[model samples]
Target: MEYRKLKDQDQDGDTNEEDVESLRGKAISGVSLKPLAAFGVSSSDRSKWKRKTIVTFALTILTSSQAILIVWSKRAGKYEYSVTTANFMVETLKCALSLAALARIWKTEGVTEDNRLSTTLNEVIVYPIPAFLYLIKNLLQYYIFAYVNAPGYQILKNLNIISTGVLYRIILKRELSEIQWAAFVLLCAGCTTAQLNSNSDRVLETPVQGWIMAIVMALLSGFAGVYTEAIMKKRPSRNINVQNFWLYIFGMIFNAIAIVIQDFDAVANKGFFHGYSLITTLMILNHALSGIAVSMVMKYADNIVKVYSTSVAMLLTAVVSVFLFRFHLSLAFFLGSTVVSVSVYLHSIGKPRR
Candidate 1:
């Protein structure tokens, strides 16, 4: 990812004395690069930081709003429409968007030898793997709301950070520092503390089934994220829109199959859009945008930025839930969220010194 000093090199691959002299003059005119270098900030690093900041902000908004909208979209305890159908619709939308972007690229860049292999099955076959994994993880997103409220879901979702770290190391052969390992332990303890309720007899508000589903969802999310990252990184030169198109194409296929298997009779009895409302439409848009945002994060930024953004969203969701859903902010929830926030910071900046 490092960029060489293009201005200092000529077409003949030799140093340009004129360019060096020009830079030297600029330095003489009170434009020294030493101050920036002193802080270890280069032009490339600044560019990267800017991109990461923008993507992190987008992720924070998309993630927090999506969680809130999902909870609000539910009527009573269940969704009137088929969850599988909804997921299928989201994937279809994403595929369309990615295709449109790819078409724009083709129009401007022209289809050449570089992208000729983009759509072939041999090149795109790995997409379906993460697509299927995402299908399961997304379905659980809707189903888990049945057991826990919005804030509780936000807190529990952090479990994926732990699972992601494990799979990221195991599958990608990356190394985590000892501090990051302790941060994972702290994250688990924070989630457990969030679930504690002094007023309830059972201690935890979420049922056993809810915990099971949450664990399964975390595992699926971790694996899908790591796998998708692997696929994207495999072809570092490939356009991300092409990758997104294939992934979403397979996502739509898998979700369609799920709809047929699980909701064929119900959809036949009513309709695909039978119980959909404005809230439902908004939820669909939120999910579609969220998926696109996550893909961009994986492509442009690393998962550490994603973790920080989602961690901020966790707090944002809890705050929004208080006014919208009348969610009580308990002492345990505060302490737990504080701990979770600390864990996230520690994990993000806990890398070993070079």
Candidate 2:
């Protein structure tokens, strides 16, 4: 009687019986996807989620392998190319591959001629900043290697997390909670403790210059890493291939300039691949792929994730060093490993309180 009375009161009411029944059923069933929607995830689709998982796994493997390969390649006695020269080779191939891929994408999707000029101009203006930063960081690594051992380099470079966190706040204007800051400090301390060398001879051999360079690299790398995250976030829809093509073009150009400046006549006298071998090519390809891999990580996530990735790679390198590279594993390594493990857990599980 009451329902009929209410229905009769609204003469032009358009909501039908079927709609009411469907909504009532939904309310009873508690069918809600708002939580998932908030995270930008679709609860309705499982396949897309699985694909993302696979990609992340692939990235982890690629990142870890790249770190090991770099150490193994450079220290090996037979590689003929100079470090900077080899870096030049890596950037060249990286740019070429990216350009080819971009061309394929453009041909398939069809480019807008009107936007071509703007795209070119933007690439010209913005892309080189990161590429030049890359050049500086790479050169610093070589200098660091000259002054210190691998362990020292890893320990010092891990400080990028602190710098990254600080800059992430300033540049992105996203504040970190006290807990997050504590976690970052814990992470740095743990990694540093873990890689501390016990042997005095190796320590004494590495001068203060290497230590200073490593710190400088850490600061610069943090800025570069955060800057990359900002770029991806600002243009989330930008084609990764197109952006990579521009970025690598500048990288190639800058690296070429570095090689020429370091040795003015080497290009004409001996050629780009002077004393190069199969190993050099493999190393170059591996490093190039790593560049792509890290960029993907930065695009999808943030520098914090990349920092953990480097930590994992560092741990793996330490293991490889112990078994194959004939490096000593000190007590600090075990303790530091434990601390770093805890830090990773803390960072993963700790949530910001509302």
Candidate 3:
């Protein structure tokens, strides 16, 4: 299929070019797809929904588990392992997993030009931009944690939802309805409220530097997500695993560079597995899986869908923490979770303005 035709079909709401081609073939054979719309649902719509639901669910689970495991792995007040080194390992692991998946697909289908590892420089060049943005954002997170408490960090982090929505509109030229814009605001507000604690003064004591770093981090996150979706959707017929492989390649490169700049001596002295335990291992796996899951969501859904998944994961993490760590769940959290739920529903059903 020509790239223009594939792009047009994507804009028409087809999740996969192969599915669109299949439907066209059936239509040519005198099978009408119009009848499927009589029940208010089409095959393509159902396929898209199924993919989004599965990927979003996986992301939610992986994100929530990662949070819990990170907390569990902390020794005294901090991690005994080098965070930079662990992040490098995570990128490396994600790259390996992508390669493994690509290998399986090749073995099953036989490698064609489409599935082959060979690609033009233009095809893979854009991926490094997001990888670099994410590297900076991840590094800034550690710095922000020094000046802001967890609650404050959560509140500030919700700003990414707004930034993502704005970037999604500007980059994709997709118009959102007024209700959806309102829902974006509600999501940010709801997440902020959920993380607020009236009894704690820590959230109120954030320094100017922390606020600046948090804002920059949010903007970087939003830009990276939107840009990634743009690239994935650019060639709808491309294998997602192939795209993931290129993405993880740059991610591994960037993170390896970061490790060298930040923690080379520590890793050399203590070795890579110095502070790794069962819980830490699980945390690394979870982190790697989450990165893959995010790429899947970008392929199957969009950045907005990812935002919703992570927001819900935050609530789930809090609920689970209450049981595992005996953490308190205040009325604010309950109210905020309710609002987040409502906002998600509104956005899911939100129509695009004509």
Give candidate 3 regions above 4 Å deviation: 1-40, 75-79, 139-150, 199-210
Q: Which of the numbered candidates is closest to the native, going by highest lDDT?
A: 3
Task: Report the error of model 3 at residue 151, Å.
Answer: 3.8
Clashing pairs in 1: none
Put down candidate 2 lDDT per residue, 44-124, tens digits, no spaces.
343333333333444466556655555565576554445556656666666676566555555766665421213756545
Query: In model 1, what is the error at residue 335, expressed in angstroms?
Result: 0.5
Residues 1-354, candidate 1, lDDT per residue (tens digit)? 000111000000000001112222344455445676689898767555555555567768977887676557542344466666777777787777777666666677788664442577677778888767765665676688788765576557667777787887888887778988887777767755655675433325799888899889888877777887788778777766677777777777887898898889989999888777777677777667767777766766665556656666766887898999988888887887888888888887898666
Which whole-number lDDT from 0 to 100 does residue 348 have in model 3? 76
lDDT of 3 by residue, 266-308 (tens): 8899997777667657766777777777777788888888888
Ranking by lDDT: 3, 1, 2
After superposition, which runs of candidate 2 have C-alpha atoms over 4 Å from their true positions?
Answer: 1-56, 74-76, 112-123, 136-154, 200-214, 320-328
**Local distance difference test, per candidate?**
0.66, 0.60, 0.72
Say which prediction, candidate 1 or candidate 2, comes out ahead on lDDT: 1
lDDT for model 1, please: 0.66
List per-candidate RMSD values in Å.
Answer: 11.7, 17.3, 8.5
Higher-TM-score candidate of 1 and 2: 1
